[model samples]
Target: MVEQSTRATDRPLPLPRANLLHLLEQMVLIRRFEEKTMEMLALNRIRGYCHWNIGEEASVVGAVTALTENDRLITSYRDHGFAIARGTPPETVMAELFGKEGGCAGGRGGSMHMVDIARGYFGGYGIVAGHLPLAAGLALAADYLGEDRAVLCAFGDGATNIGAFHESLNLSKLWHLPVVWLITNNQYGMGTSVHRASAEAELYKRACAYEMYSEQVDGMDVLSVYEATERLLRRAREDREPSLLETLTYRYPGHSYADAGKSYRTKEEIERWHQRDPIRLFQRYLEEHGILNQGEYDLVERRVSQKIEEAVKFAEESPFPSPDTLFKYLYAEEGTK
Candidate 1:
């Protein structure tokens, strides 16, 4: 078994030598996990909508790795890796996508709405930009309650243009809420490219409109993302400020699993991103640095692959939620009078 690096100090720092290895492991796990989801989708085992995290693994893993379990996470539809990195088990997440009773959301939320509140992952929202205010509100509540926890609210570039993005970011900044608006700018908002949709393509500047601190980083390099996010997240936690981090990345796969990475983006475009695949890049760095031998890296790959297989098996064997149990935990229960 791979040695679990749960100790925060023992875990890799944001460096090419150390943090890069953890980032690579996360990227590989996400890749394998998404591949399994696609296989399940093809077999009709996973119903409803699904988005591949194939290309955006670096953003989710890098941001979440900098956060503690107490920090809140809410994101848009493309959310599997975010959930996994935020502490939702692979089995529960897969089962949720599979619509089984064992799922984190009790099989109700389906592919675009996986939630594990215990892990502080509030939800994966299906409606675009639906969770922006929810995250901002979470930060507001945390502030009101004098809690030390911060919130990491993630979304795609497309949602960044929507009303909620503007409204929520403004609110968080105005009130100095403990929130980090982490936007994964993967060039396209579904089928629409960022250059076409966004009036000002440099989204981090949007934070300046709210007079919030902002940053831009190469999303493909997980080390760079972690370095930036760690600084911003710590600032947010310490000062209860709103920060915006725009990661310039690309999605090798299509907007959703239904679309097979074609149409707008050509084969050459996708192939280019494959050449810089974050997992492969860090794996190379790991081998060169001796932090991970080629043999050890292979072992990590095989172990995560096995974990994915077991998660699939668990999802396949899990039963669907019963009709009688529907709506059991949809909302918070009323307090006794």
Candidate 2:
């Protein structure tokens, strides 16, 4: 990651009208929904491992919006917002997180695997580097199936260090798979900075080694993310070439709800990132463009609050999956039996 900004201040990124509002709404929804999840987790209403993609709202909103409906998406465990933005109903995601029967994976797949294949979401993979290869397989499958659709594999900076990431990218290039690797490098690889763990913190350069076209973008800027993703997605779809995008973003909350702002991160660092929050940035753009007034913007926020309330309500009122269903979707069944 080269520094595009130095001693001089850089211009604040801008967004257009409709897209600006849409991005704002999505970020609000994600914020409200995740806040609800954290509340639920604190109350012990939702069990199992839960990771929230809070501060990385811009990356989720912008990248998913720029993708085609048919383009496949595969992301890591911190995927509540990712799934929702990919058009998976909040109710399903909430229910899935709550482990209810109506959840995306029939209540079985919890936070780490709420995949709606119908929407082309491959999964919320739990294993760190496990899904990278799976996504490469998906891209190769698309090529073999002769479909124009491309696979969008979203992973974190941590996975970049894993060997599967390297092997997967090698294969993706070798086969000319139509795919785009969207690496959300949120500064911290777990609790350590990229520089702390990686000798060469420029992770995008890994793409260049494979001759894969790559670019680094300010993940806090939704417009910049959208533009870059739009271009990358267009090229992947049009040329069947694979690309890699490194989103230099930050996570507002600690690594997980259980984390207590450990020694690795400081209050000032978190506060600094909060200043350029994606939600506020987009809302400001909407107001400046005169597309939405304060009242209208308040409506979006209120709607998100209500929507998240209903989603939690729906999950609360729903039933958990029966023990019999445990073995149902797990493996192949009865035609041979």
Query: Candidate 2 lDDT (Cα, whole model)?
Result: 0.84
lDDT of 1 by residue, 153-263 (tens): 888889887898899999998899999999998889888888899889888888888889998886776766777788887888898888999887788778887776587
- Model 1 steric clash pairs: none
Worst 10 residues of 1 by lDDT: 1-10
lDDT (tens digit, per residue) of candidate 2 on 155-179: 8998898899999889888888888
Q: Give the residue spans of candidate 2 off by over 4 A.
A: 1-16, 335-337
Candidate 1 local distance difference test against the native: 0.83
Instruction: Name the top lDDT candidate.
Output: 2
**Candidate 1, residue 269: lDDT:** 74
